[model samples]
Target: MKPVITVREYARLTTDKITEPTLDLAQVSVSAFDWLCKLNATFSNAGAALVQLENRCLLKLDNYVGVLETPCGTRLEILPKHFEREDCIKQSRVLLRRMIQVSLDLPTREVGAADLQNFDAPLSEWVMGRFLLALDHLIKRGLRFDYQRVEEEQRFLRGQLDGVKQMRQPPGRQHHFQIRHDIYLPDRPENRLLKFALDEVCKATKDAGNWRLAHELRRVLLEVPRSRNVQQDFNQWSSERLMAHYVPVKPWCELIIKQKIPLAVAGEWHGMSLLFPMEKLFERYVAASLDKDLLQDARLKTQAHTEYLCQHKGKNFFQLRPDLMVLHQNKSWVLDTKWKRLNSSGEDKSYGLKQSDFYQLFAYGHKYLAGEGELVLVYPRRSAFDAPLQVFEFAPELKLWVLPFDMERGVLLGAPEGFPLHSQQLQSSEQSA
Candidate 1:
């Protein structure tokens, strides 16, 4: 059996300790450590700083969380650092899946049934199961077909005759006619890409159920050929309004086909890195939640780049993109999410808030909100920082709110009095508008 170890974000794996694994620490053999070092090296070479190697034998995980499998069948599961409650691993795993689903714009109901049924499976297994579920959905909706042009020799010509090829036939093959024709078939680029993804997932999945499902789907797509060149197929893939159901499955297929680590180094380690940066995951999750929870009249925009921090001689430089921008009537609010946990202890009077963060938010307030509206720094709601802190005033008209977002409730907490939220203020604004 594979050695499955679970840890939280910012956890460490050490080769010096051979003791039992804990939530934040684990012991791996030298060989496993070498595999990790290779993995880190590959990530660095690909311009991604996902993990850091300490000393020589310690492998430290940064903010990237998910599953990392080694070539030797050692699996490292990293969960969110703040999920410290009972059964936190399971909770974090489910939450991570939801975040990925939201980020990919997949409906929660479509790919979550199998996930909920297999709660204790590894992250990789869950991912494979999700892909299989998506394939199943696509199969039920009916596989799409496209016209494939073919040139062949037959007893009778069906399409335009290939006179040049027919004239070159041997003496005994005078009856055979060379024809070029287009046939409506299921061997298009999209189905080929899906078939390739299914093949990759079949090899990577560890669950028997996933294997069986993949096999069934492969049988269903028997007419579709596996992609000979994935990149070429991707270039040829096109979206059609009629095949709208393909939207949710395409991302999963691409995710399965491409290694997340970003480098294709030649080595014995061919395992997949199904990791996601916590910052991006948190930002996208918060944006999606806010969009769903906000009133219809109020619109939320993500990563809006309508402003710049400064202007140069001939061009505008330092473009500012706030994570979440809420527009209600004539009012605009700029909210940026931080995946870092806040320190609520008295020893840290600043609540561990970075000075640079305030500067960033101040810049955003001046540019995005016209320097007079409310600016928010949203952090995950943990036990230490379950409520909003006191508001900071940059000026008489400019105020910055450091608020906590309740992950469980999917709501931002402790907005100041008279804030434009679900209260009468928002209602009145909508009414007035």
Candidate 2:
């Protein structure tokens, strides 16, 4: 069975085939229903499960894909938008590669067996499969396990006795001492956490009927000890060690660590979810793309915090951090990327531009660029707004350009017209003057 299905089709599938139709959850697979319930519980408002259409469930998703699994071994992948699979995979790879570089300070390796170019799979499957492949590779190369000192409270009269005499039970009962043993053990918190995550992933994959991925994950999990303490306890050194040996898995590890919860509902673990906030992903992709495509002399900064828009009594507050800032010789361009759909109507709806966004951009222009230079609002190209909107002036001197970043090409659409002229021109004009 194809794991991925559109939300509309799913809703239809769960609905009764009658004139006055009602949703019947029984129509859908048990696993899918469980997955939806879990999503509702975990994500609440932000979850993909949007509303209940009678017994049918409606999902609210766009430009995103969710991988869901139930305890009964049902795997349901939901992708709301029908994006070009190759393009989506490529963009995802770009984002993950950049994340690994930023977080681990390591270069990305060849995707190798996990390459999504030829693979026709759902987004969730691809992501999980790629992660499993990376993880398996790292494990075969040897997991970065470190010897850690362990302390145990044991009932022994021979070993190192407690320094506190009162706690020694005064020679009446069996004297137990809390002995700190420096035994080199592989069951460190980091290893345990990794093991725990691996176990969860293995279960999820198995439930999803991804036998190959599950097998690989299980093989890795065998080496690491099952940890009762699923809490995150790794320090910077431990992370460095793990990333040093397996840099490609850094992003996956971070995601697992952040999302893994020990609580089990319905006798099955609520597996870790790898959700990429589209806003941040778009921002990162745009920044990385611009860094390469922009002029060599041009400097680009992501999440640049150079100024504060407001201040309290002797303290600074309400700082402005623009998504992307490009600085040239004598001028700077302040740009912010918004991951939202634009208005389709030809009428002047400002292309569904938010008033607060304009206000924010205006502040960025006034504060960051000294109320000069070009201020740009960047958004991903959608069906409604395919091309760059006309440039408008917030003030006579400050221009706000609304441009689209094309996902398929992985480049800013109409870049030449969207970006402002280099500051070198201004310098030449000034020199000539």
Q: Name the top lDDT candidate.
A: 1
Candidate 1 regions with alpha-carbon error over 4 angstroms: 45-47, 85-87, 111-118, 157-160, 167-173, 259-269, 345-347, 416-433
lDDT of 2: 0.57
Model 1 residue pairs with clashes: none
How does candidate 1 score on lDDT?
0.80
lDDT (C-alpha) at residue 325 in model 2: 89
lDDT of 1 by residue, 1-433 (tens): 6788888888888988655667778887788788778777777877776568888878788888888887777888888886766357777877777777766565555555565646777777877777788889988998888888999988986999998998999899999999999999998888999998898887777788998899988888888899998888887777778878887787778778763322233456557557777888888888887777676688898899989988899789999998988888888888999998897756688898999999999999899877898998999998888878888999989999999988765677776544446633564566689
Report the C-alpha lDDT of model 2 over 1-433, residue by residue, as the tens digit: 4343323113343422234432211234545655655555654454443334344443333333344444444544433232324224344444443433332333346453344345555444554555566677777786555655555666763345556653655565545666654554556565576676566566555335455666766765675687674444444325454457655665555454553211112224564333444456567767766776676677898888979998899888899999988887787888899877686567656678899999999999999988877888888777777777788788888888888776644567644333433333443467699
Worst 10 residues of 1 by lDDT: 258-267
Best by TM-score: 1
Runs off by more than 4 Å, candidate 2: 1-4, 8-64, 70-76, 80-114, 144-185, 188-190, 206-210, 213-223, 228-231, 236-243, 257-269, 295-297, 305-319, 343-349, 382-387, 416-433
